[model samples]
Target: MQNNFIFFFYLLAFLLYIPTLILGTFLKPPTKKQISPPTPQSILARIKKGSKYTKQALEDFEKLFLNAQSCDQTLWLEIIKEFALSPSLEIKEITSLQEKLKQNNPNLQNEIALTISVAIKERK
Candidate 1:
């Protein structure tokens, strides 16, 4: 009976302390974290670094169409579609590239058609 009373007292004390500790923590306000502003050089450098996925896409594009560089217009479009859907390149890069290709090839300009054809098709 004595041991049982002591154990019950300790257990009661332990259970009571938990809520106070949690309440103290909850009452405290959160602090804001500081982040340094980006510099022009660093920003430009990051963009220049370019995404690795894009580089891989470019390499894949070259390999896939290596033998058929000047071949059918349709297959070229599919390859370009894959290139554009890559996480590597930006929308502008793909658009500018498509323009340049059209200017040079003329025949393959309207080949791929939409800007994000593959991505749009896949979403469905």
Candidate 2:
């Protein structure tokens, strides 16, 4: 009876070890998939250009900004409306704009600047 018990224990151990050995043999690291660092081309690919919305917005933005800078209320409001419908300008310009607006509100200065930026981006 002791011999039978020892045989049972050995058999279980062998069974567990066999699966581990087989899995280790079959499960190998993938050879085809190679991860490479980002190149200039990849970075360039991320950049987007040429859009009607952006073009129009940039034009209006530039116009408004210049108009406001020069204190031209007549042109500023008209340009602001044109850009309001499409405001997909650069983030840096937008941040600067928000800061400008906060610093000086209801003064048409910041509004004109943002409007002109949008217009410029759209053009190119």
Candidate 3:
């Protein structure tokens, strides 16, 4: 009975020490720095970068149409949709591109036409 009581007393002491062993009682929690939200200028810069990337993608598509480059149909489709949705490209520019695509690939011409129609519908 005495041994059992001693065993329990040591067990209780060991259990109490576990918390201090894992996290020292004297240690302070680390401080976190505040994060600032994006400013208007930063937003504008990002938009400009996106516009530049869109223009470059359109140029790549033009190269493919001109037979100076080639890409898979799925990539072509993505570029077509991106070009159509871009506010940077004018309707007349897309129309001219549609004509060029007609001579190269009917499918791309149709996709461009669909995009143009959507743009027009959105405007109305």
Cα lDDT computed for each candidate against the true fold: 0.57, 0.51, 0.60
How far residue 101's Cα lies from its native spot in candidate 3, in Å, is: 0.7
How would the candidate models be sorted by lDDT, starting from the highest? 3, 1, 2
Question: What local lDDT does model 2 show for residue 65?
Answer: 49
Which 10 residues in a row give candidate 3 its minimum summed lDDT? Answer: 38-47
Residues 14-123, candidate 2: write the lDDT tens digits.
Answer: 99999999999999978897876433222222222323345544544443443344444554444443433333545565546445543554565565566655655664
Q: How many backbone clashes does candidate 2 have?
A: 16
TM, every model: 0.40, 0.33, 0.45
Better of 1 and 2 by TM-score: 1
* Model 3 Cα lDDT, one tens digit per residue, 2-117: 99999999999999999887788668788898976543333334334666655555565565433313545554444555555567777787677667766776545666577657
Candidate 1 clashing pairs? Answer: 54-88
Which residue ranges in model 2 land beyond 4 Å of their true spot? Answer: 28-37, 49-88, 91-124
Q: Highest TM-score: give the candidate number.
A: 3
* RMSD of each candidate relative to the true structure: 15.0, 12.4, 12.8
lDDT of 1 by residue, 1-124 (tens): 9999999999999999999999998898788988754433333344345565456546444444433354555545555665566556667777666666666665445554563465545533
Preferred candidate (lDDT higher): 2 or 3: 3
What lDDT does candidate 3 reach at residue 86?
67
State which candidate has the highest lDDT. Answer: 3
Evaluate residue 4 in candidate 3 and report its C-alpha lDDT on the 0 to 100 scale.
100
Model 1 lDDT, residue 90, Cα = 66
